[model samples]
Target: MVSAENSSLEYLRSLVNYDINSILYDDTLICSLTNNTDVGSFEVKVTKTNYGNLHDCIQVIANSQATIDGVACGTTVRAVVTRELVTVQQEHTEYVKLPNPITRIVDFISESTDYVITITNEEGKKKTTETKRIPKNEAQGLILEGANLILQRLMIQRNMPDKVTMLSLDSSSELSRNVYTSLGPQQVNINGKDIEAWGIQRQIFETKPNALPIAWQSFFSIDGHLISRYQVGSPIKMKTRNIPEAEQFDEYLPKPEIPKRELEWENDLELRSRFIDRRDELIDDYKSYIYQHPDINALLSDFLQSVLITKPENIIDYATEFFAPFNNQTADRSLFRFADEKIPVPKPNISLK
Candidate 1:
C-alpha cells in the first residue's frame, strides 16, 4: 500500500517525464501583499514567461496600480534570470518604489560594480549621495534564487540542493551572505488547512570576521508558492478589531478660552468689534491655546486612545474617568503633569501679601 507521502513523492517524480512541469512557473497569479490588520494592501498579477528580453532567459513581471493615501500609485517589477551555457547567471531586477504623486525605478544588476555618488536636490539644496549599489561577490541574486527555489521544489525528495548562498540587499553598508539550507518536507498550516511544504532555514552572515549569523525560516509549496516566513525567535502577531458604532461626544471636546478684555472697563471698541464682526476669535484663541498649553494636545491624545481601545457606550464619560486622576490639583497648579513637562517660574514670597 502506498502511503500519502510516497504517493506525493511518486506524483512529483512523474512530472519530470515530460514538459508538463510548466504549470508551476509559466502562468499568471493575482497576489495580494496584506496582513491581518487590513490597514495597507496592494494586489498585482505575477506572470512568468519562458521568453524574456535577454537570450535564453526566464522573466517574471508584476505590474499594477492601487490607491494609496487617496492617490493612485503604480508599481512595476521585472525580474530576468539568464542561462549562460551550462551555468545559470545571477538575476537582474528592475522595480518601482512605492511613493506618492511620483514614483521612480531602481534596479540591481550583478555585473555592475558598486559605488556611491553625491548630488544636491533642487528643492532642499542639500548635497546627498545620489545613488548607492550593494557590493556583490559569488552570492546568488534574490530573483535567481527565487526562480531556482521554484524549479528545484519539483525534485525536492530526489535532487534538491543541500544549501545555496544568497546575497542580502538590505539598506545596510555591508552586504551579508544569506545561506539557505533545505530542511526537507514538512506540513504547514495555510488558511486553516494543513498543506505539505518544503522547509528552508536561512542564515544571514555579516561581512565581519567571526560574526554570528541571524536565522530565518520559510516554507514553500511544491509549486513554488511561499506559505509563510518568520524569524526564529520572534513570534508573529495578528490582531483584529470590530468597527465601532456611532457615538456623539462633541460637548466634551476642548473649547477655546475666551480672553477677558481688561479694556472692557474703559468700554473699548475691541469687544464690540469682536461681537459685531464675529471674526472667528474662537479659532484664533484655540490656536493660541494649542500653542501655549501643548499638554492639552497630549491629554486629548490619551483620551482618544482610551476611547478607541475601550469603545464605551458614552465616550464622554470614559474621557472623564480617564482624566479624573489629574483633576484633583488646585486651580492655580498645572491641570495635568507629564513626565517631561515642566515650567520654571520663580515662586512669589508669601511676605509680599
Candidate 2:
C-alpha cells in the first residue's frame, strides 16, 4: 500500500497529466529547467491611479509544473494590485494691471517733465521700476513749455496726438525738432453733447539763424492727409532808419576804413541811435501817462488776465461784472500812472514837458 504523502504526490502528478496545458516536472526536470530549485505558479492583477473617476487594471499569470512518478501537477495562484494615487496641486500665476493711460497723459502735461513708471504685481506682492522720457518734455525746457501749451489747448476738447516723435533739436538754436502724427478723429461725448474738432499733425525742424528758429507746423484732415502748413518765425527784416553820412563819419573816425568795417560801423551807429531814440520815447510816454493818471495797477491786472487766461469765454461774465464801471478812460488812466512810476523824468525832457 502507498503512504499518504506518496498518494498525494501521485494524485498531484495525475492532475498535471490530466490537464493538457500543464507540463510535468520532477527533481531532475526542475534542475534541467533553470538554476533555481523552488518553482511555483502565480497570478497577478495590476491597477493604476486615474486622474478622473475612471481607473485602469492589468492582469498577469505565471506558472511552473512538476511531475512525480510520471504524473504532472500545477498549483493555481492569483493576486489583485492597485497603484498608489498621487495628487498634484496646480500653481496660480499672477498678472499686473498698468496705470491709467489718461492719468499718465494728464500728469505728463501738468508737471512738464519726464515720467517714472512703476509696475506692481497683483496682491502688491512685488514691484518693478521703469523709466520713460516723455517726448513732450524731452527737448529743452523752452520746447517742453511750448509743447505743453499746445497739448493743453488740445486737452480742453479731449484730444491728443496719436504719436509724438522727437528728433534732435537744432544744435545752433536749441529748438525742438519733433513730429506729431494724428491717428484720426475720435468721437467723444462731453456733458451730454457731441462736438467735432479738427485733428492736427505737427513736425518740427531746426533751421538757420541762431537768433530766429523755424517752426514748421502742419495740420491734418480727418483722413490723415496733410492739409495745411504754418511757418512761424522766419522773422521779416523791418526797415530801419539809414544813418546820415555825417553821423557815420563821426561814429567811425577811430575805426579802420575796410569795406566791411565801414559798413559795420555805419550799421552799429544806426542801431545805437535807433535804440536810444526808442528808449527816450518810451520813457517820455510812460511818464506822461503816469502823471496824467494815478490808478495803473488795476489796468495791468486786466491786461495780464486777457493774455494769460486760458478760458476767456468762461470768465467773460465775471470780467464784465468786475470791469462794468471801468471804461477805457479808467484803463488808460491806470496805465498812465504805471508808466509814470516806471519811467524817470530826464532833465531836458522834464523842462520841455
Best by lDDT: 1
**TM-score, structure 2 vs. true:** 0.15
Clash count, one per candidate: 0, 10
Model 2 lDDT per residue over 1-353, tens place:
11113332232223221211111111111111233233322121222223334343111122223433334443222211112111111111222232321111101111234322222223334443333333333332222222222232232233343554444234232334545555355432223444332444444455553544334443322322222223344211111012111111123235776665344533688877988899999999999998788677667677668657655655667676557656774554654466546667667646655
Candidate 2 local Cα displacement, residue 228, angstroms: 21
Worst 10 residues of 2 by lDDT: 20-29
Candidate 1 to truth, TM: 0.38
After superposition on all C-alphas, the RMSD of every candidate to the true structure, in Å, is 31.0, 45.1
lDDT of 1 at 230: 47
TM-score of each: 0.38, 0.15
For model 1, residues 11-46, the per-residue Cα lDDT tens digits are: 333444423223233322222334442222222223
